[model samples]
Target: MKYKVFVAGSGGIGEAAALLLREWCEFETEIFLGDVSEENLAKAKNFILQNSQKTSVVETILMSKDGTNEAMKSAFESCACLLDCSPGTQAPRMARFACDFKMHYANLTEYVAETDEVIALAKDAETGFVLQTGLAPGFINVLAMSLYRKFVEQFENETIEKVGMKVGALTAHAHQPHFYGFTWSPIGVATEYVKPSRVVRDYEIRQIPALSDRETIIIGGRTYEADLTSGGAADLPDYFRHKAK
Candidate 1:
């Protein structure tokens, strides 16, 4: 069946998905609903209309704090997927709702606590909830797994040297600057960035400070500084002990 996807928060990510869906309607149903003020939503809509070659068909909802559950149900009816780009605080609540309602939950959320919570809940529930479904986590995961398999196959007997990954986000457009700008709450962005980061060192999982690893990247005449991210890799310690080296 063609997927009817409901984006739970008509912010930047939601609107992006909506545009992509409109461009690829034969494959998915993209609808954006959120509690953002009407002015914000209208601005989002205008942006879509301006950038998109085709007419953007978006259904909007003004959500209230007291009525989120009902709003979610209403906007989420018949949705094959729920993409939550709401604030970090809302992710856990949305994850629980998705689990309780038997909905597939996907988010671009960066909250380790919330992601961990959802991961725990998924252990008992019959649904799949993915927290890092974009850029760093999503695509990086696929490529990393591939390299992992190759390393295992190629180094079946050799003592592995060191394993590390270099990842980054970039805009294909030269005019656009610095990876991307997601339309999300300032609180969500700040909270995730301010929190400590964790990763797998060898096989051991450990927490690393965020923005601590600064490296320079150059493309043509442009130079930019980037740093390591915190969070993700929660299962490394339980699965392996390669950190002692």
Candidate 2:
């Protein structure tokens, strides 16, 4: 059965997921390559052609924010799964679009509240809504669930004393201007870094600063620093805390 998949972002994340979907699934996958410009759509298309065979690629709608909502409506009505690879703040509208269209939703937003909404969507729906399915959120969620399941299987009743996670993405030959970004989103990065966070302090929810959790460290040959970031805590605590019984 050729399941139809629709993708709504054409930047690094969207394009990458679409390409991988093309590689892995025997489904009819189409990407609505919406960007704020035509060049971006062209670039995404070109990149897709380079990585994937030029078949009837589901369909590519080169619409943007200023672009019409007509195509968005059509796409929402069509695809079985809507995968979002847009900006961190753009998750709600995209996810809402999928929900209104009666389609399954997935995305790579590292924001906790956004992910919470996605999870809430799954409560009454039959479609799959896999939130935070990328590097930190996706893989991290899988691993955490695995460990949670393992512990539950092993001991059944006890409080989980602690959970600590460390994950990051870096580019080679790191530069200071963008530090670790090719296409930098300074505001978004700053917002995340400066966002006040909630952490399990002595087994109780406590507010802490994300970047304030920073520490300098020595690596293989150089020293670097990283602040604690919340990638999976929004929903995991609820899952783990409940299962710790």
Candidate 3:
């Protein structure tokens, strides 16, 4: 059915997501893009309209930190879902608004504390809430689960020794001293690198230093380095706690 979606950010990820929804959604969509900056809102709206199908109905809203503005309130009440692509710190606030409006909520924040807050806020709610729906925390976790399921089916055994999940966002060109370029926020990369990673060790959840378990591996006949980054495991470690080692 045709529905409305309220997107809470106007950054790169926000614009890209809106474009994908408008171009590929099965039903006609009405999207309200909200942000604090007028420049960003205009840019994001124009970007989506230029790339999406002709039937796309895109509008912009000026959002506040507390979500108290009349325009923001109207959009929230109208939309069926809130897609939060804002900064990680804004996760809980957006989640509160979603719960208050009784709309399905989804976000891409990898911040553990913020994610925990969202979980607590929506634990008893009737509507749906999906957290950490980003690349490493989202896609990689799903892929790991799929691989585990396939292995169990083929081997007919549940005593799995190990399930390794890794991800790297490498730049095409690199130099020494760090040998990395920024595809994402530098602060985010640094935060994940230094934070403790949640892992399953000996059928128990353990917190280990990020970048401590570094190794080299070959993929497609080319050698590359891999390491454990914080929050990438998502909820897999918890799910497989007693099921796999």
TM-scores, one per candidate: 0.75, 0.82, 0.93
Cα TM-score of candidate 1: 0.75
List candidate 2 stretches off by more than 4 Å.
54-58, 64-68, 120-126, 155-157, 181-188, 215-226, 241-245
Total clashing pairs for each candidate: 3, 0, 0
Compose the digit string of candidate 2's lDDT tens values, residues 1-245: 55667777677666677777776666555555555556766777778778877374645775557434777677667778888777777777777767778888888777777666666767877777778777566787677668767886899845676665556667777787766654434554665677766566655566687877777877788887867666545466555443332
What would the per-residue lDDT of candidate 1 be over residues 1-245, giving only the tens digit for each residue?
Answer: 35656666677777776677667666544455555577767776676677767653566667666536565577666566677877666877777767766778888766778777878777877667777776555666656557766877887742344444456445454344424554445575566467887765655666778787788878788998767665434333333455222
lDDT of 3 by residue, 25-143 (tens): 88878889999999999999989988875576899999886647999999999999999998888989999999999999999877777888999999987799999888878998888
Candidate 1: clashing pairs of residues: 197-230, 198-231, 203-242
**C-alpha lDDT of candidate 3 relative to the true structure:** 0.87
Distance from true position, residue 154, model 1, in Å?
2.4
Candidate 3 collision pairs? none
Better of 1 and 2 by TM-score: 2
Question: Which number leads on TM-score?
Answer: 3
After the best TM-score superposition of candidate 1, give how far the Cα of residue 193 lies from its true spot, in angstroms.
3.9
